[model samples]
Target: MHRFYLPPDECLKDPPRLSERESHHALNVLRVRPRDRVVVLNGAGDELLCEVLNAERRALTLRIVQKNAIPPLPYQVTLVQAVARGKAMELIVQKATELGAHRIVPILSERTVAQVDAEAVPDKVEKWVASTVEALKQCGSAWLPRVEAPLTAQAFLARGDRFDLTFIASLQNEARHPREHFESFRSERERSPESVCVWVGPEGDFTPAEINAVRAAGALPITLGPLVLRSETAAIYSLSVINYELQSKRGQNGHLK
Candidate 1:
């Protein structure tokens, strides 16, 4: 079924209207017609199995056939990614959403090659947001990841938000293996944490001072093997591994996988 995300408040109306962008995608790109089965989702854990009533409007009129409230994932994942050059950031945002990142916060670090001027951040963030929407549709994900405005590494670290677990992927040998973090989590809680935040640095990796700042902010250092993956790759890879570790339920005892 085709899936599209609508804001939660709008999805509650009797006959919900698809947003202009969604309408264009359905009518122009997909050429959908009346009676076509589609699903309208609001990223806040609600979805409607609906049929198109009219595709001619700026907003498509949808006849909701079923309503469902999907419980949020047991573990909420936050990705703190340093902005990358070109379209790399969009790739990070798209895959992060597909892999189930509940939020994406772009950080500007000393090594970050991406431009972060005041006038540019909003436009860039908007494009990233659109990418998330498209990714949600393509991946059939009911949850949309919140993309925050780009902030400097210092400012982001200053927030000092606590999570059940926080980790920063690093290339240094001193960094513990990701397995260790997973094992520690299960050992401590008998299950995955209710929330996790993973930080992936920019192109050249975080400067020594930046690393210290993040560590001081309470993020544990973890490694993704020996290979030096690019910043965008690191972001997606970290999320994939975390999702696998937390999502896998093969062992009823929650033993180390």
Candidate 2:
């Protein structure tokens, strides 16, 4: 069955209408027909089993058959990726979403090569979000990750400590892999953190000052492995590790730690 996102509010009634854009995709691009079974996601962990009712003139209507509430992940992971040039940035967004990042933030670091003017933030975020949406539909993710506006390193440093757990990818050999942090956290782990944020800097990576600031803000420095990884690779690989442990820590009891 094809999956699509329609916010819960918009799906108020049984025969709800898909939004203009999604309607066009369903009616024309996908050519969905009446009686076709489809899955509609509310992007808030709810999945509605629906049967197509009508598709006409670039409009779509669906009748809800069943609603399923997906259980939330054992832990939330946020990916803060430094802005990179061209396809690199999009790849970060796409792969991160597929790996189940709860939120995606494009950070503008001192060494960031991709610059987005203040006025362009909205459009850039929209593009980033569009990439995530594709991933969400393809990966069957019920919860949509929020794509935040570009944040400067300064802004990130100031509030980065807000997460229960935070990590900053570094090239320093002394830096530990994310598994180490998760293992340690799980060893005597009293409780799983509600949220975790992983930072991956761009190009030349973050400046010494930026690293120091993030470290001071309680963001632990960690490396993916022995080899230095591209910013996008670091984001996806690190998050994949975190996500795996998050899943494992949630035992059959439905509790982490």
Candidate 3:
């Protein structure tokens, strides 16, 4: 079934209507006709199975046929990613959404290649939001990850937000495999973490001082094997491992495959 996105508030209308952008895709692009079955997502865990009532250019009307409320993931996963060059950031956002990341924070590290001026942060964030929406529709995900304004690594660290388990991909000798940390957490706590965050540095990786600062802020150094992955690859790999260990139910009983 074709999918469309509507915010929670708009999804509640007596006869829900797609936004202008979505409307164009439904009416002109997809040529959805009356009585066609489609799915609408509120991006807040609500999925409305609806039938098209009208497909006007300006307004596409849909009547709810069924509504499914998917519970959010047991644990929240936050991706603190350094902005990569070119379109890599967008690709990361899309894959992160597909992997069920709860939130994404784009950071500007000292070695980041894609430099964004202060005034351009909003525009960059907007593009990232669009990427998430497209990903949601394509992947049939019920929840959309919140995209945060890009911030410097230092300023972001200053926020002092903590998670149940935190990781930073690093090449330092002290870094250990992600599985080791999961095993240690399971051994000590006897349960999977309720929330997790993984930090992925830019092309050249975080400066030693920045790495030390993150470590001081309670982030464990995680090694992504012997090979160094790009920023986007590291982000996807981190989220995948986290989803496997935490959301995949394998760790519920203190064992993860």
Candidate 4:
């Protein structure tokens, strides 16, 4: 069945209406007709099995047949990605969402080349979120990842205490391997962390000062492997690894509580 995203407000008791853009896609592009069964996601863990009631150029109305709650991942993973030039950031958002990242925080590292103005942060976040929404629809995921406004390395570190596990990908030899670092945390905690956030630097990586700041804020330095990876690659790779590790653990435990 085809799936679409609708805001929560549009999902009340009354028949829900789709936005003009979605309406056009359903009416003109997909040629959906009345009584067609489809799924609509609210991006807040709710998925509605909806049937088309009306289709017009400016609006598409759906009647909810059933609603199901799609639980989020067992372990929440947030990617602190540095703002890379051009399409790299967009790719990061798309793949990271598919990899089950809970949130994406774009960072401004000392070595970052892309300059995002303060006024543009909202627009940038919206664009990344739109990319995430597209990925969710393609993958049939009900929960949508959030894309946060960009922050500087220092500012990001200042809020580091909120995460149960924090990792900063570094090329420095002194850093521990990511698997080993993650395993160490698993052994120590009674239960796996509910939230983990990994920081990926820009094309040139984080500056010495920025690294020190993050380290002092309790973020551990971890290495991906011997080969160097671009900012977007590192973000997706790290998220993939984290998702695999957590999902494997869940399988071993039989189910999540």
Say which candidate scores most in TM-score: 3
Better of 3 and 4 by TM-score: 3
Angstrom error of the Cα, residue 205, model 1: value is 0.5
Per-model TM against the reference? 0.93, 0.93, 0.95, 0.93
Candidate topping lDDT: 3
What is the C-alpha lDDT profile of model 4 across 1-257, one tens digit per residue?
Answer: 88888977788848799889888888888888999998898888899999999987898988989999988766788888889989888888999878888888888887889989999888888888888988888888888888889889878666644887889998888888766765676778745567888888998888889888888878888888899998888888888777776665554342332
Per-residue lDDT tens digits of candidate 3, residues 1-257? 89999999999899989988899988877889999999999899999999999888788999999999998877899999999988999999999999999999998888889988989988999999999999999999999999999898789889888798999999988989888888788788767788899999999999988898998999999888899898899999988988877855454433443
Residue 43 local lDDT, model 1: 81
Report the Cα lDDT for candidate 3.
0.90
Give lDDT per model, in order: 0.86, 0.83, 0.90, 0.83
For candidate 2, list the clashing residue pairs, or say none: none
Superpose all Cα atoms of candidate 2 onto the true structure and report the RMSD in Å to 1 decimal. Answer: 1.9
The TM-score that candidate 1 achieves is: 0.93
Give the lowest summed-lDDT range of ten residues in model 3. 248-257
lDDT of 1 by residue, 71-130 (tens): 777778999999988989999999998998999999988888877899987899999999
TM-score of 2: 0.93
